[model samples]
Target chain A: MRSEIIITLVGMGIVTYLTRVLFIVGMKGDRLPPFVVRWLSYVPVAVLTAIICPMIAAPEKHLNLTYDNPYLVAGILTTIIAVATKNLVITVIGGMGVILLLKFLVG
Target chain B: MSGPTFDRRQIWKGFAESVPVMVSVFAFGLVYGVLAVQSGLTVLEAFLSCVIVLAGMSQFASLPLFAAGISPLTIIGTTFIINMRHLIMGASIAGKFTERGLFGKAAASYFLIDESFAMATAYAEKKKGGSVRDYMIGSGIAVFAAWNIGTILGALFGNFLGDPKEFGLDFAAAAAFIGLLVPQIRGKGDILVLLIAAALSVGAYLTFEGSWYILITGITASLAGALVTRDEK
Candidate 1:
């Protein structure tokens, strides 16, 4: 690898590792206030929602809420399947199947 | 403090639960590998990023910047910003590792990717007690293996694989996230948090240019949740 590539990768690695490790290392064995714990408890749901909504709403980088958008159609149906079954494997399989079917039909 | 006991059963459970998400991670890694090589990175560099950086999205984000001849510091800074969400994920799971010593916590931190974090969190929510630290490690290893293997294969033969989107591989991550998120919802409060986060996330995603929407929406919605819900004894 080139010197610049090496430096960039190493730098990126260091910072990324820091981000992953900082809080866990810093707060180990330390108790926090109850409200702080409560806030942290909500992090997973909030963060996952934040990540998922945009991707499904705009699979092509622009919002398309119509039925023509296979991602929207599949995302909604997959979510329903997820809620009804609560099985990750089935949800994923059903999701991929629905999207492929939608693409084949819509195309 | 005692080190975390590496429970084989919990680890196996973690690995098994992670299998569903691994499909998407592998797909993304393949896509990343192809893009990295296409962007002028050598196969070694692409593989090295997967092994060391281990953050797929930031790695993907950095490729364009690196190809554009941006300064190394700029690329690395953008990477830091893109991965800032890890801080919240780490803090959220930190409480679970209180019994573990620094060495255990430090070791576990390397495996704190988004998928593993979500899986471990969901697992913890479902099961009243177990070694989440060990579970996280197991799931992390499973994801790490899938990613690296996919990168190697993709870099080697990416041209023939075609677009991952054509097969709807891109939806795998969204589907996995949905599956994990749905089980965590119990009451009206959880539903409220989900709605607020989703609305703000979509709005901020449309409005903003970078990955800051995740951190912005995550913190704001979670804080709103904390304030609105009554404290249980």
Candidate 2:
């Protein structure tokens, strides 16, 4: 297990470093291709949504769309606050508060 | 020295802009630390993962896979795909580092996590009178420090404190991502892309394991956005 851990860490480090430095090393002073730039502009939203949605929809490792699901309830409440306020602290705090409160009342 | 150098004032401003992001990163990191240890990793292993990989979501996504005794190569592949977005992120900001040359860029890019990249790129776009590299470094350093500190604390004391999920600490990552994502939606195309991304993500999740869905759905959804917006211009 220790050996496996070392191997995984080393491999992950190399791969992550390569990605982080890919453009930095190769691009020099040139502008990125316009098409690439347009596509890249959407990457963040795509990736972030991809990360968030499944977790909310399946907090238990499977789909749970029921109204009683605390995560789903808090997730909707959080999404509304997130879009409305655009403040990180409020969204996180407000969302967590809702989740815990719902868990207390519902669970 | 001709252009804006790494002055104290600029560094201070950069640090100030980063405090909020750093707070969220710290929260996420603390949760990851606790969970990693609970997932059968040693404290030292968890700490090393933080210092080495430094990517939050991938780290969290891989913990369960690792504990399941999956192949190391497969885990590495999963991590790489989940982080491939960084290639685009690095490329987007590569122009700002032209003056710094290769070594300086190599140093700065090491700390180019999502928050630092967003903060730095937004600052650069404003054409502000400060060194973009310096601002990035400041924000990056704060995030790195907070992550490492949070990891250490959680790894050592997490088991004693009980499960992080009991208080909805499990929602930290999702909440942070939503907080980050909401600000990026600018137009109908972005909204369309986001919905497509969410749908594809959940669909892919049903068919896939780990974080492959994030990579596959994210890139595909971005392509959908590109196609949708192509006729606009």
| Most accurate candidate by lDDT | 1
Weakest lDDT window of 10 consecutive positions for candidate 1 chain B = B158-167
Off by over 4 Å in 2: A58-64, A84-96, B1-28, B31-42, B60-75, B98-101, B118-135, B154-157, B169-176, B208-211, B230-233
Error of 1 at B75 (Å): 9.9
Give all TM-scores, in the order shown. 0.60, 0.75
Among all windows of 10 consecutive residues in model 2 chain A, the one with the lowest summed lDDT is A28-37
Model 1 clashing residue pairs (backbone)? none
Docking quality (DockQ) for each candidate: 0.45, 0.53
Candidate 2 local lDDT, B131-164, one digit each (tens): 7777887888888878888887777876675665
RMSD of each: 6.8, 4.7
lDDT tens readout by residue for model 1, B90-187 = 87788775355777788888999989999999877876588888899899999998999888776776445456577565675567667768987877
